[model samples]
Target chain A: MRIERELMRGAGPVAVLKLLERHEMYGYELIDALSKRSEGVLALGQSTLYPMLYNMEAKGLIESTERAAPSGRERRYYRLTRTGHAQLAQQTEQWVAISRAMLALGILPGPTTTQEALA
Target chain B: MTTTAPQHESPPAPQRLWSDILTTPVGDLLRGRIGARCRPRPRDLIATCGLPAELASLVWEVVRRTRLWSTEKVAVSRELIAHFEDGLAVGTSAAELGVSFGDPAQAAALIRRAKRRNRPLIWKAAKLAENAVAAVLSLALLLYTIQVVRLYSHAPNITRNYVSEWNQDALTVPPAERAWPVYLAAMQATNGYWEHNWHGDELSPGSSSWPDITEFINSNGRALELYRQAAAMPKIGLVLGREPDVDYMVNNAGQPIKNAGAAPDPNPEFISVLLPPLTTFRSVSGMLKVDVYLAAQAGDAQRTQHNLDAVFGIVAHAREVRLMLADLVALTIAGDACRTIGALLRANPQLFDDHQLAQIAHRLAGLGGPEGLRTRFASERATVEDFLQRYFTDDGHGDGLGRPELLARLAVFTSGDPAPTRWTPTIGLNTVLMPAISPFMAGKREMLAKCLDFFGRYEAEAATPLWQRSPTTVDDEFIQFRTSLRNEVRYAPLMILMPSLGRAGLMYEYFAQQRDATTAALALALYHRQHGSWPQSLNELVPQLLPQVPPDRYDGQPLKYCLVDGHPLLYSIGVNRKDDGGRLPSPPPDGTKTPLAELNRQARRWQPAPTAQRGAGAAMEKPLPDGDWLLWPPVE
Candidate 1:
């Protein structure tokens, strides 16, 4: 759980950047894509999503273009700029090593077989 | 049964959270709870502060209620709750709600919305939201919309209460410093007017208008003192008719000519009469409004037909000054309320341009209009005092005493050159024609015959008239109209001080807009010059602010002002015009029409801060009353 918190807390900005790395996505699609990838483990608020995306865009971490939804509603399409992709790569490697150290710990004496890998 | 989909598990009882939030502003507290997990939109920034504050409260109520009725119960995240529950309720209230529904979160939120919405005020609020939701839901219904159901309403009661609270002393006559100097002075002048009339000479009221303003200072002197003592009253003004109080016919000796019976002389009727109090001499006003009709259904067929035909004739053969639609534009401009309506007319042309149209527009302009005048039935005005001092010594007639013609003798006391500049004793004996004179013009006549006419009218009644008409005219229609408006307005008389102020108040606006940011720099400098002390009003910096502040243009009245921090506020009680927005010399905090403190209160209603201050206004939506305006930033 502690490992999950650490990874999830900083993972939002990095994960948002990763989704935008290939192509731009609207808020609804961005949430859906991330949910599918994380298998519902990370559930970020749709409300909080825009301000962060907009703040990063202001900071030049990403670039955005306005697109019309199929219903003709205006939506902001967010894409990772060069700096955003670079930051995402750096954050991904750091989180991978830390996540490895946590899962490697084996239970000392459990009723279950120790030779079996933890589900 | 109404079908509602159970979207999520019921939430735990949020009673503890709700109670904690009771002390805080409900808007903020509710937003924290309900606004979570929803699309982020600007909430507090553009909140419509319209009528019925409960609408906002209801929205928050519904949101918080929904959250509590959900299945989350005790599992509700702290981030989702805007307000904090006390330690006691953290365990109990949540458990109670959780026990009700298998899903504590869903049930808690639903119960909260339903419970808070139990009142009639919330039912209206739900209707408000439902309408907006309907607009987005059904385009067909939205297409034919003439007006939308709105949560915020501009209530007559709120403004009425505001005006009444400020107008507590509207009719109070304050005590004078020297005990009604103008009344004393007018009495002395009457003696001179009497003696001259007997000598077949005339008297003209010179410089009486200046004394005319004394009633404002005198009549309300005691009330003002009380106000000053209590420190609770705002500035309310009194009108003095702007003309001399007593008109008289006099003899050659510049004294009024009285009969041997010591009554009014019948020859030319030489006598002094006090005209009705001055409040009636003020101008009238109108406002802007509209009504839509399915068709021109005439109210009265005869009158309607006459009105229609009159319009056609007027348009067909209109002459110079024949009253056209343009006249309304001119009247609106003259009234100084042209900005809003003028812009509307400029936008659409197909809606109007005929005589009947202008007439209807003029009628609408007076919809919910303000009264034409205030302070009616002023019979007890200090200016009409009844005290008289009489003395008889020697007549200097025949007993070997030298005597001259009345005019020649009165002239000895008042006249020197062919055109005299000082007070003269020589006057006429005629006083019978006074009733023919206009009371406002009694002081301006030069003929010996006219002086007789001026003094003839004294006991004229000024029982209040219609809002648009008063002071009794040949056509009593204005009287009836003015009365109807007064009845309909059903508010305080403070509204009458707006329009005349609307015109004269331009001086301060001019000063505010002066190129130097000059007022600002000067205010800042003065604030610093005073050793960081604040001055009470702009008058302290009059010669400092400008060469001299100008009198009002509508009626040559002087402007009043006050200062807060370093910026100056300028105002004038409009003469029976409803544009000053009820700004007065001294306004209470809760008074309507957005006086200075109220402006600040409106600006800082949510968050209290030192920088939260008042000006004429910080923006357009917050416009200050015409006379009751302030400079934006305090200088220095």
Candidate 2:
């Protein structure tokens, strides 16, 4: 199922930052990777994703540069900045804690192993 | 995943119209400024690609609706096109991609907000300033409209007629006892010949103008007799608009009445009520001086005393007007009479007996008695209050706003230029605009208070003796008080109504000194007659020939006295406030001392020099000439 808008608003930037933390990605590449990896649950529209990237860049959480792809088409690439990396680490910890609390209250299914739940 | 041909889902006309609106001149100027950093136009790669017309049109629609910087629109367009193209390669249908893109308006708004946040700091500040200016202009326009309504609704209520009130005493005088008619006849019979011929010099036998002087005396014998008869009367009894007599009206009304057929309005506005011109009185006093000099030359002490009495009468008549200007004229006439007395005593010392000398001295001593030297500001205050009433609206609590139409009327009256009989477009425009601006000016109560405060301070300062007063007192205070930008705007009516009385105060002091010196000289003359020699000092003449020694008005000291060349020399430490051992101002290059009459002229013309700096720069500066003012032996 698709995430609710408010939850997506919180999750979207962290997801993008996590992807960019691995390697720089253009707009289309990031969208494709997010859909496949999150099984379309964390998917964002072209309308929402571009503005989100622009806002993150404005806040210095991400930076963008224009470059030519191997296909000879000009594309904009985004990457995590030092601030973005720190924000991702902090948000990841918060998400982990939230999952643990949900499991303790039986709102989420208990993990088969503690390691599985943490992962 | 498989690709399908793009579906033509949305209409094309609306998008084209929106695009056309953004390219207008004003829009283009704004866009160029907002997009200043977006240089080297980006190629529309989506147009070159094999994208369906529907998909390409959608991308252009969203970009156009954003209304962002051109560079930002291009970037957004490129990214969206690439996202769609990538989706197609991944087997997403074009119709499904369009549905996922959501509303074009919402997307444009979101992108626009985010993009604006990334704009340069100067651009953001400029946009803020543009909004602020618009808000301020709107507020100012609203306030102006409110003020316009307020000013037009209110009008001045003139309850009291100040002119009739001012004339009450003069109107109550019995016609039989009135001296004004005799004075008027004297003025008519005098023929105004002295006014045209005399160049403001003493008309003694020694004067260069003595030929005209003899003719003037011979021709105006009847006029001189009338003047003496008027002088001997108990009351001046001058009333305004009582008769249509031209010279009488001109003397008391300042100007001839325009509509002579109509009786003077009993309750006329105060400003329109003319004050008596001092010129006629001053001219008559001047003629009387000539009469006194001629009598003294003939050694006729009785004629001299009668003529002197006429001069004093004219002074009292002028003083009765109760105006600062009239009082100044009175002092001036008194001073001229004193100087004439001094000249007579010096030239013809044997002209009068001991009794005649004592009488002359007593009359001179009383010329400007204690209250005479004080400039009265009551009439002046009344005039300003009357002006304020006419110039502003009264709300009964003594507070009200200015009425610009009345101000314009006052301007026309005081300017001495006749106002236009017919209204023109310029007058109409002034009528419209004056009310709009008058609300920002001083209201009646504040203006009255300011005027009273200024007059109060000035009168208090003037009451003190010259030596006790500050160096830069009345005139300096007036200049500083009136010329400030804030005061000029707020107290404009007060500025217009108030006369410059500072110099009038100084002039009163000068004339007071002249009167005192003449009294002491007359006393000395009497003592010389009795003792056959000048006294050892001015003290010997006191209580016998004089009541008390008159102090030098310049420094508040006893008048300087000494025997020079075995003749009594009398003088005052002058404006410099230093004793120069009774030495006079340096003589002319010919080594002849300036005649006392010439010295008197110089004294009247004197003005204080600017104060010098107190430190080292003062030493390098040229100092003002320090001289004693010679009063006795007549400087000749």
| Number of the predicted model whose TM-score against the real structure is largest | 2
| DockQ for candidate 1, C-alpha atoms | 0.01
The runs of at least 3 residues in candidate 1 whose Cα sits more than 4 Å from the true structure, single-residue gaps closed, are: A1-6, A103-119, B1-636
RMSD of 1: 35.8
lDDT of 2 by residue, B459-525 (tens): 8766766666765766677788788988777777777778777777777777777777888888888
lDDT (tens digit, per residue) of candidate 1 on A1-119: 12375656687788888888888886656766776787766654433454456457655788766545575544557788888888888888887655544445433333243234344
Tens digits of lDDT, candidate 1, B306-373: 32232222211111111122222223222222222232222322233344334433332332225211
- Top candidate by DockQ: 2
